[model samples]
Structures are given as C-alpha cells and as structure tokens.
Target: MRLFLLLFAAVFLPAMGSSKAVCHADVPCTLGDRSYHVRAPDDWDAATPMPVLLHFHGWGRQGDLIVNHGRIAGHTRNRGVLLLAPNGLGRSWDFWRAGSRDTDFALAVIEDAAKRYPIDRSRIYVSGYSYGSAMAWRFACEGGDGVAALLAISGTIPQDETCASHPRDIRHVHGLADPVLEYPFGPGGDPRGAVRLWRDTLGCGAGETAPDYAIRPFLTLSRTVWDSCAAGGRVTLDTHPGGHFIPHGWIGWQLDQLAGRAPRYP
Candidate 1:
C-alpha cells in the first residue's frame, strides 16, 4: 500500500521543471538566503499586462511542494497570470512576530515578479492555506494598499489591532469538520471570527441569512457573501462539511472574480 501511494504521488505530482519549461522558463529569484519560484502563462507575451498571484504554502511545506502538489499551476494554466510561490523562512511563516522578514520577503517576491513580467499592478493578489493563510491575512492587514484581493483556505486571520484602512476584496474557505483548523475555531483558531473581523473592518452591512445558493455535486459546500461594503470591499465565506482542504474548482472561480467575470459557479 505504501509503495502504491508512492507510485501515485510520483505519477500525479507535477514536476517543477515541467511547469517552468511550459512558460518559456521558470525564473528563480533569491532574497537574502531564501528563494522563490515564478512562472508565467505559456501563451503570455508583453503585449498586455498580466495579473499576478502570490501563493504561500502551509506549515512544513515549501515552494516546490506547492508547485508540485498544490495544483495551483495546473489551475492557472493558460489563464494569463504570473504565479509566484515563495518559501517561508522555515516550515512556517512568522505571521505574528513583529519585525519579521516574512512580510518583506513577500513584498520582494512581488516586486521581483513585476520586474520580470508585465504585471497588472491593480490586480496583484495573495493566497495561501493553513499557516500561509495567516500570512495572507497579515499581508492584507499591513500591506492592503498593494493587494487587490485575498483568498485564504483552512486558516484564520491573525488577531492584529492594526490593519490597512483601504478596503479590499477578501474570501475565506473553511470546513466545519476540519481537524486541523475547525470551523468557527478549531485547535488553531476561529476562521469565522476572521470573517466577521473583515466584515466590520470593511464596514459591510448585514449579509445574506443563508448561503446564496448551493453548487451541484458539492453538497458539502455553501457560500455567504457580503457585497454591501464600504470602499468597494467585498467579503465572502465558503463553508464545507469536511476537514482542512480546498476544493479543486475554487482557484478558477477566484480567478474569474479577479478578472471581473461573473462567478461561473454558486
């Protein structure tokens, strides 16, 4: 059984070099002692500015692991976006530590990608899972001015008193049965409280009583949205019946939202 699982991972996991080769070549950027990976769409040209996505991995994970197993590159393929995945200092990002270099590393990754690709400054976005999600929220709080949107999965926002004044689009996904990070508050923390925090910060009015609607085939999933917000902010929460995991369709849906396209799913 262990051998079979190994074979499965070997066959299914994407090769880091393969994705880099697809986009002409993968660009490796080093900041201090850490390095990050950057890949552009295969069909990209300098004719138009492309959107950028900065994805951070969960605890005990690195950029190569996400590039290989996270399915981020596969989802964004042909989507005309530059994808950047950065490694944390160790197994986790120092989200709560003041004077931490993680935030600076994130910003440096973005600036480096912009220098290499024609990135749409207004469409720069950040996303992550687990510990990385906390970093995403941290970025939204301290560096919201540079981020247009934030997508977090299986994690809660940090309890920070100071946050960016400008409103930005925010979306969170959490599972009620998440053994790692429970629904409202698991052993890690409460992701729903993070949602409420953003709602108040963005000045969002009362949201829908229930999910807007359910998506077919995913009975475990439901969504709540707060559209009436100040400073053009919008907040959304997606709940699921299972544990800490992100749906395969979420990346495409989020990309559509960033591109100003109507959601393809409920």
Candidate 2:
C-alpha cells in the first residue's frame, strides 16, 4: 500500500500540476494603469495560433462580473478560443469621453495578448453587452484594422459615431422586450438606423423578408441578413423575445459563425 501510494503521488501529482498550469482560470494583464483578465483553454498550444474573443462588460459592471454572470468564458473555452474580458474605467467604458483613451487601451490589450500568446490576428473578434456593445461598434468602426468580426449585444452605435474604416462582418443581437435598450427604437437611439447604416455601408441591396424561427418555445428568434455586400462583408441582426440580457445559445452560435460550421443560429 505504501509503494502504491508513492507511485500514485509520483505520477499523478505532477500531471495534475501540469494540467492546472495549462488551463489558466483567469489572470490579469496590466498595461500602464489599465488591466484586463485573460483565460485560455487547457489544450492551448503556443506553436499554433488560436482565435481570440475580447469581451467588454456593460455599464456599472466589471470584467470579472461578466465572466461570472454572462457565462461566456465556458462557451469560448469549449470552442478553444482565448477569452479576454476587459474592464472599463470605473466600471463603465469611456466611449464618448473626449480625453479618454479607451480605444487605445483596447488596442493595447490586443497587442499584449498577441505578444503573450499565440493569437490569430485574422480571427480576432470583439463582443460586448449594453454600453460595452456601443463601444464594440465604435471599436469596429474606428480601429477595426485587425478585427475579423464583431458581435454587439443589446446595444447599437451612437447616432454621432461614424464608420470611417472598411466594412467587416458585424452581427447585432438584441431582445425586443428590452426595457433598457428597446428593440426597433429606444429613447437613447434607433437600432434600425444603425442596421441601415451597416446595410448601406456594406453596399447590400434592399432587405429581404425572412421568417422568424423559434430558438425556444417561449423565445422566438428572427434574423435579418444582408447577403450581397462588398469585400465579403455581411451585416446580420438577430432579435429574440426577451429582455436586456444575452440568450444562452448566442455565444455558441457566434462561435459557429466564426468557425464556418453552422449558420448564425441553430
């Protein structure tokens, strides 16, 4: 029994330690005064480049809060995509702050990730909820040089913002019953207008009518896709019957779209 226990400790303990080292739970990467949390899967290999998903939290929420409440880290981990959850200044993103360098901070985070890990530059994606969603749109529009795709949830671009960069694949997800950021239109801004801006910018033809599909018995989902666009750019709008929160299957479906495995939704 003693020898058996000795062998077990000699073999299994080291392996367990190695596994723990490979599967990082979440670690903070500090750049100047700002920082963000990064989590990678256990099977990550430094030699092979992997896709990265940088997620931003909504107003009054921090990076760790979204990681715990949003439950997107597990989805990204299952898909073998590195997850980056960046905390905005004072629990909110500075999207409209004139002197705030939030955009530069985001870029720095990506650059730091590339340096620290095997990040695929062509597959870098940005996603956010609520106020962070607005920042996501702003990021894609202004500094979308290396971003391959964007996922904006529960928010749209501000009316004053403009897309000065080239077109890219953008998917917007929102719930019709959201009281905070209402669907179709809201006191803050108009989602339809934002969708129209992308549609026109991407050079997509007139919108086509499509049937709404049921993701669940209670949650009916509809998708508006702009198929014909320049530079392979596509704009998609997904609406569901819910409130100011992301659906459970949204992250997985976004991963599928990125991997080219399945359509935008199940």
Candidate 3:
C-alpha cells in the first residue's frame, strides 16, 4: 500500500502542478495604471498560433464576474485559445470621450498577450456585454481592421460622430427586452441601427431574416443575416427575448463559429 501510494503521489503531484501552471487566473498585465485579468489554455503552444477572444463586461460588473458568469473560461478550456477579461475603470467602459484611450488600452492588452502567447493576429476577436457592447463597437469602428471578428452583446453602438472609421467585420447580439440598453438606447442608435450602418458600409445585402430558438426561460430569439462583406466575411444580428443577458444558444453558436464550424442560428 505504501509503495502504491508513493508512486501515485509522484505522478499526480507533477500533473497537478502542471495544471496550475496552465489554467491559472489573474496573470496580471498592465494598461496604463490598470491591471487586468487574463487567462489562457493549458495546452498553449507557441508553434501553433491560436485565436484570441477578449470579453468586456458591462457596467456594475468586474472582470472576475464577467469571466465566471459568462462561462467564457470554461468554453475555451479545451479549445486551445486565450480568453482575456479586462477590468474597465470602475466596471464601466468609457465610450463617450475620444481622449479617454479605452481603445488604446484594449489594443495594449492584445499586445501584452502576444508577448507571452502565440496570438493569431488575424483571428483576434473582441466582444462585450451592455455598456461594454458600446465600447466594442466603438473600438471596432475606430480600429477593427486588426481583428478578424467582433461580437457585441446586450448593448448599443456608441452615439458619436467618431463612428466615421469605415465599418469593419462585426456581429451583434442583443435582447429586445433589455430595459437598461433597449433597442434604441442612445442617439447613436440601437444594435439594429448599428448593424444597419454596417450593412451599408460593407455593401452587404439587407439581410435574410430568421427565427431564433429560446434557450432559456423568458427568452425568444431571432437572427438576421447581412452577407458578403468586403473580404467575403459575414455579419449577423441576433436578438434574444429576455433582459440584459446572453442566451446559452447564442453563445454556443459563437463558440462554434470560433471553432471553424458553421454557426446555426437559434
């Protein structure tokens, strides 16, 4: 029994240590005075550049809650990728000010991630919930060319003239019943309005309409398609039935898209 126990400890302890080395949390990085939370896959390899997914939280939420509540870390565990959840100043993303430098901070986070991990520059994705969604669109409109895709959840686009940066590839997800950030939250327009702007900017069709499946209680869903981006990319607008939360199916479909699988509308 002693020999068996000793052998097990020798093998299991090293494995446990290695696991901690891989899925560890907070792994601090700086953007000005701010220190943000970032995580990566345990099996990350430098030779195989992996796609990156950055999640921004809404107002009144921190990075840790965003990471846990959104289940982003869990989704990426077996996917061989990096998931960055940066803490915004006071749990809010600043979109109203041009000189605030939130966009620069986002890019800085990406650059920081690249220094430690193999990041596929062409496949970097940015997403956010609620107010963070507005920031996501603002960042994309200002400097989305560096990323491969964009996902905005339960939020509206920034209502600023700076939206003038030629539209890039982006996908929007929102809840029609979102009281905090409704269909037309700001003068900048709602998720639908922002998507429409992109449809025109990208020269895509008006979009094919489809029904979305209910994945949760108090949820109805719908999706619209704006096809044929400038680079053969695609844009999607997904609406959910509930409040300011992402639907399980919507997130799953996004995961599928990231995995190079055909995304099914639900």
Give per-residue CA lDDT, model 1, range 1-266, as digits (tens): 65664454334322322332212223345656777876655455434677887888899987766654435776555577777889887678987744556878898878766655567988888888988887877777767687888888887654435565432788888777889865655235644454876877877887764543433465456777888987568898888777887666676578887787875642
State model 3's lDDT. Answer: 0.66
Question: Which tens-of-lDDT digit does each residue in 142-194 have in candidate 3?
Answer: 76777777878876554334444443457887776778877654345544564
Ranking by lDDT: 2, 1, 3
Highest lDDT model number: 2
Better of 1 and 3 by TM-score: 1
What TM-score quantifies how close candidate 2 is to the native fold? 0.81
Clashes of 2: 0
After the best TM-score superposition of candidate 1, give how far the Cα of residue 109 lies from its true spot, in angstroms: 0.9
Best by TM-score: 2
Between candidates 2 and 3, the one scoring higher on lDDT is: 2
List where candidate 2 sits over 4 angstroms from the true fold: 1-26, 97-100, 184-194, 214-217, 263-266
TM-scores for all candidates: the values are 0.80, 0.81, 0.78
- Tell me the lDDT of candidate 2: 0.71
Residue 10 displacement (Å), model 1: 22
